[model samples]
Target: MLGGRAVTLTVSSLADVSALLAALPEGEAAAAAAAAAREPRLTKPAGSLGRLEELSAWLATWQGAHPPRFERPVARVFAGNHGVAALGVSAFPPEVTVQMVANFQHGGAAINQLCRTFGIALDVVALDLDHPTADFTQGPALDEAGFLAAFQAGLDSVPDGADLLVLGEMGIGNTTPAAAIACALFGGEAADWTGRGTGVVGGALARKIEVVAAGVARHRGLPPLEILRALGGRELVALAGATVAARLRRVPVLLDGYVVTAAVAPLEAARPGALDHCQVGHVSAEPGHRRLVGALGKAPLLDFGLRLGEGSGAALAAGLVKAAVACHTGMATFDEAGVSDKG
Candidate 1:
């Protein structure tokens, strides 16, 4: 129910999307173009700065400042279990959720490693969707009334002074729900978004699609909240709420993979401004992922064919953001660096 309140406000028209898109600073594109033009004359070989210069311009535009600043970066990973796992949609068992949460807490997960490397703070939250609730005694699960409560807890836990937020997931069998949700939002076949989640094999993949299709069928014509109740996982709901909270707080969100993006759709629909703070980390290897990004009108930063969840892509993309900020803040202007200006 955490995101339930927010989901009720979903946007249902392209006009809504247009208005939100229009609100983003027009100066960002102009700044990026200017940076692209200026990078060639910085006393270095022309275009030697490569993507770094482009990234800086983007950061400047996004932050609405000539030089962007990345003061504090935080990665938030949300974990939950799914009731649909009974249908064999995932290769890994539900136990992995608890295990991975523990690993994250103890500093063994990939997110933890990446955060340490980048000097970004990490926050992990465990939510119970409907099943495997016994393991996550430390966190609240989604029930009729506890949904919003869980989401608020996660929102409040985000560290003070954080400038960027990266959202990741740790739920077994979640891809099934994510695919179903994407298909509903985009009106696509379940198979289109289905992939070998956590190394699920051929037959398992087939069964996963079948099960998700059934869920989608049962929930047809229902509202987004009801669809979520019937087919969505708690982690997804919580992530959606967090996305809204981040937007309201004016903190940029670095999105990881499909599951996280799926969670954000409801928020993006409800408050189009919510997405202005989001940066797609990468184009996930999952076929459905590209479709989702396209639907959201976003271009991801990387394309290494990575399918691993846990905010890995977001963590990796953080380097690009840092470099962009550095270029904006560290690079000297034409007059200050004493570089010749092209009249």
Candidate 2:
């Protein structure tokens, strides 16, 4: 029901989901157990270090080995325009979307710097979800038909054998529509999720809240497809489609923030198991982002109170995943190290 072209598999009951979850590799758990069993002898008392030790063990389990590797990780930033910018809900003008896209292409944005620092491969895709006029220039600037084409293009662009994928956004007024989409999917008032985006102050914040509420009100009884059409951006829709494609290809997706999460909701609705492929990178400063994460039943890895929305949070967290993999792969088990399991 969420992704227009997605095929809904017949899942009759909760048992089906249980079966699916059961079939997933228990490697992470096994790795965790192994890591935990080895920690007491590493010149530390049992459980003295608390969460960091627990996290290391957890990563070992998730990687399904005593040590994990996050080598050759990739971050993909998806860019598009939201039609709601016309509603004047943001401080920056809509042209900033295109300008920022150019900035990203030129390797000048925060994500670029962070990814370069971490040695992560970065990929950018433009989704044609809205028609930007001469007044507004950054694009996968597409009408409905063009959006569909761009969606397919995004699906095709994913590289094979990618260990991780981080989805990010670059639309100027996208938070307005992102909040609207969140409200529609999760049954909340738009104002509850709306927040000041991009340093909007005073009257601009109030206007943003009002615009989101209006969009939610307008799409109240509409179907998901119609709601997306009415309030969604090209980037959101393309990300949703790309999420589905990524799942089919068996790659993990790291959601950057509220906007990227909202864009990928249709994928969750379309393929319920698809959510398993995603990891939320962080809790965003955007008010709606927490609500969205709650709706998806996901806990973010970090919270730096970020509101930048340029894959900054996701790029930042990539280092953690790498460390996780390193600990999982490099640390020896008690049996291998000939240490007693007991503290």
Candidate 3:
């Protein structure tokens, strides 16, 4: 049994995870070059389109075409209750994690609304909540078996025919674990990585910082995967797995804010080029998020002071990606429009 629940998977150790994920097919360089060449010939001032041009080129490289398809985007929100929530880290209770999962299923959450607006399908993977991982401040949050199981759940959650993926998470007190993971990976003080998740402050916030610091102190020198095993919540491990899986599948990933970013930090560490498969949808208002994004070397598409998770930022950014694709494909060249090029 794993996480107080039975979990079935074929793999035994973290090493098997690398075997399960192959390198992302290098996005088509020829196609990207061709798209870049076409952009200059378009009936517009040079560089007038700004980041849309970059987005289109990115899509072209990944899709192996000048005009890439951005349809059938999928958003996966992994839900779990963190054992760290037993501390006063979050303003919300742990049960809210389960309640939010139901809200996601019932189409009542903000993410559901955003996904509907963007016409993206939503999938929520619920981890074993009957037994949340142990408090990482004292012990490993998940045993090796449990961590492997959550990782597999992430890999299994990726749906077929998804042109792109948006990753999100729902777990009360998750920020504590995420911050702990970041601190371990980035070599920072607990205060550098910790943030006020769900708006906890004063004594609650101080306690949260202490808890993350303790977790980081307890497991500072472990391997990347072991740090994840020791300090990560089930949902976080699952999201990291999903990011790697999406890369292997050659699907681009739109990453949601802080917690999600922290979850993937170790994956990026384990596989150096893996994060090239993803783009940040937005930077969360959470302080640790910006540091993590910088660590990944990604510039966010939006920066609206959003701290809400559950794929809200990713869903909003998907529309912009789709628009970028449309503009890249639909815009006419100077030759086609019979307009003379500026010599």
Candidate 4:
């Protein structure tokens, strides 16, 4: 019923997702306070560590410990094909989605290398590799049953014993659907919500923008779930399910880039404050990603113009999170170091 097999679910609607979705566990405020209290007593000037200190405290609060442990950090890359890829939204063809899934399986993708470098476990979820979704510009991307199925498949992919979960996606032309969903949910012009995905420009970029505009215009005024049904691909649906599952299980999620961020957008709108359990891995080169990150009200941990999905950004940021956890737990306090506290 949870993570693993895509079993049949009683959940048939977004309301079901919300009803079954538990809010993130109330982080240990006492632990966070304890961490902050200890920081001042460490053998260093106050606030010298800057964001690292804050990150440490956040981990403490999330884990209910003054010094949290970073055990079993994992990343999952959800790969699928979008029917909108027929529109040339991305420079890469839809076949590239299948090819890249192979790359991920062979440990040749950026995310695979990054995850290996950081000693994180990696799983590539290919739910729609051979089964692409319907083109949204023409009709609903997935039927209600299909959407729920994809959602469950994604929900089941979150690994057990994971201290932190990183979510990413690979779907050619997904940016078109992501942009359409963002425009519908966030109320922005299609051009504003769209971007130069995979470096498509000039005429290709113009057509991509037009596709998004038409898709959003057709699906306007729909509810969050309807918007997803109209515009979301299998990978995006799965990403959203994974995000909801993470929040329900009290696992902190590191979202990769634009597609992942857009996938979580509807949840934030539906659950209100659900994103408190999530963080951005990076500010991607994709323009909509900035708007998506802003809408979530969370700052990215890094900004290296990364637009390559497949959990690449999340893998890079996971290392930083692990380091923050180590610093929180391993550093010597003034008392432990026999150093005098500030008088």
Candidate 1's residue-wise lDDT over 158-221, tens digit each?
5545677888888998888888777767677889888887888788888988876776666656
Task: Give the better candidate number (1 or 2) by TM-score.
Answer: 1
Candidate 2 residues 1-343, lDDT tens each? 2112333322233333233323333234565667766676564456765545655655444434564446666777777766657767788887788788888899999999989988889888765424641111222123455445545555665566666666777888888778877887778676788888787778888888777777677665655544554567667666765665555444556679988888777555544555766778899998789888888888888989999988889888777777655554565656677877664
Separate clash counts for every candidate = 5, 13, 0, 0
Candidate 4, residue 84: CA error in Å? 0.9
lDDT of each: 0.69, 0.66, 0.85, 0.82
Give model 2's TM-score versus the native structure: 0.78
Candidate 2: where are CA atoms >4 Å away?
A: 1-68, 128-130, 133-144
In order of appearance, the predictions have TM-scores of: 0.81, 0.78, 0.94, 0.93
With candidate 1 superimposed using the best TM-score fit, by how many Å does residue 125's alpha carbon deviate from the native?
0.7
Tens-place lDDT per residue, model 3, 94-135, is 999889999999999999999988889898889997788898
Question: Of 1 and 3, which scores higher on TM-score?
Answer: 3
Cα lDDT of model 4 by residue, 1-343, tens digit: 3322343334677667666554335566788898888888777888887877877777666655566668888888888888888878889878888888898899888888898888888888888577789888888889988898888877788765677888999888888888899999988789998899888999999999899998988888887777887899888988988887765555678899898898878877776777776889898898988988887788999999998888889889988988888776787889999998778
What lDDT is reached at residue 8 by model 4?
Answer: 36
**Per-prediction CA RMSD (Å):** 6.5, 6.5, 4.7, 3.0
Provide the global lDDT of candidate 1 against the true structure: 0.69
Looking at model 4, residue 236 earns an lDDT score of 93
Question: What's the lDDT for candidate 2?
Answer: 0.66
Ranking by lDDT: 3, 4, 1, 2
Model 2, position 211, has a per-residue lDDT of: 75
